[model samples]
Target: MMTQLLKVVPEPQAILRAWMPFKSVVGVTSVRTADDYVQARATVDALVDEIRADEDHPLADVLDYLGEQVKRYEDVHFTIPEAQPREVLRFLMEQHDLKQEDLADCAPQSRISDILNGKRAISKDIAKKLARRFNVHADLFL
Candidate 1:
């Protein structure tokens, strides 16, 4: 006799309804302690996985809830620093393998060196030149 394997498929609507109570629980616990990280992350991961696995799942609702949780977690943990002008210039130069001499058409090599060495500020004129050369916003270098 051959035995058939039974797959326990959950109804999407039912899963969504079950998710609501869990979401509330996670929301209440999200700011409590470092211990909450594992639980919160697990809840989000499970919801995302379920949504991916079942197209019939309330994808928009799941995504919205997951996005909120992710934002909350990131707000608590991630802090991005503002990039300085010289650092931006150095990053751009390194990305393009540009030499200081190559920037002469844009600005003087000494000016580029001074900016990179934190001895000079990026003036509006140089910012525009860099913007044009790099095809990026001037604010990036400012």
Candidate 2:
């Protein structure tokens, strides 16, 4: 005669007990300080380097979660003044030490100068190229 074995399922809290340690190990906690935000940002940058634009990457959710945490901290502590798209572009250009000619990959120097001077607006195609070059969201240029 053979004895049959029974499988036991752990309770929800017990499952969480096993998960919390792993979560803390990966630094997945609420950002409450500048140090916490820095750590979260580092984790997000690392995740981006690993995941790139692959939505199917295993760490995509982790990146999203950490990104949200970083955004939350910034929303509370760092409020960016709203500005027009051209003004934003100018500010980014200054910050990056870029000139109209430096944006040749995004647009013609004349077009870049026009946009910076408020004589013309940024088109969607140029906005996409600028976003890629600046490593920022295209909506910033829009």
Candidate 3:
């Protein structure tokens, strides 16, 4: 029995079309050092945020691929140190564009200010409310 081989060469136009979105992600599909990896990581983060904003986004695969590249680079070069609860709280506040007054339902504005300034510890009930408000784990506030 003779085995038959099918030639499956991709069309040039199709290849170009597929490559169009990848123009900004120069590092993911190639070997990269620390600097390029950082740049790619930032690009991937922005792309992920953009994709997450749309429920039926057409760029999901691109986001997934970018995430994988970021994970790979992070596995080799990234070191994340544990942050204090206050720092985490501040980060969440910044991410949500929240001021102390915005968290009034969670706590008094003065208490929120004290927590941010490290003058007060995050209380259990306040942590729970904050967790719900920020949509993050309560332990982050704890």
Candidate 4:
């Protein structure tokens, strides 16, 4: 015997209906230029503030769409300055609450400590491994 967990999804038409009214109300569109991008980002922040304890409010999808627009604009226009490998490593470790031993799959604990402490440079091979483990671009570690 197996236990099954079922979840309900809103139908396409229902989702479209829910989205239609708010589109005009919020004035969201495909963000093509900088001004539109800024407006959409502001809209996303406003929507985030508006949504209270109810996580399932119908406006969640609109919030998601707005966030996607901001991300698309950033991908095209914004470039993150290259960071030192050790800074990147330290940031990832702190952000993820990981310790040196946690990354032993990528290298020995001592090597990880050395990399994080800037005593060693990250080789291309180790960069690739770290990128895969952290789910980030390899260039971030280079």
Q: Is candidate 2 or candidate 4 better by TM-score?
A: 2
lDDT: which candidate is best? 2
How do all models score by TM-score? 0.43, 0.57, 0.44, 0.44
Best by TM-score: 2
Please estimate how well model 4 matches the true structure, expressed as its whole-model Cα lDDT: 0.74
For candidate 2, give the lDDT of residue 59: 81
**Model 3, span 1-142: residue lDDT tens:** 9999999999999998878666644545532677766666566556544553353678766655655665576557654347888898888677547688977768899999999999999999899777545435678787
lDDT of 2 by residue, 11-127 (tens): 999999988996777775678899998787677667766765566998878777777787788778865568999988988787557788877767899999899888999999899
Instruction: Name the candidate, 1 or 3, with the larger TM-score value.
Output: 3
Clashes of each: 0, 0, 0, 0
lDDT of 4 by residue, 27-82 (tens): 76778987887778678656655653244988877766776777687778875556
The 0-to-1 C-alpha lDDT of every candidate, in the order given, reads 0.67, 0.78, 0.69, 0.74
Question: Is 2 or 4 the stronger prediction by lDDT?
Answer: 2
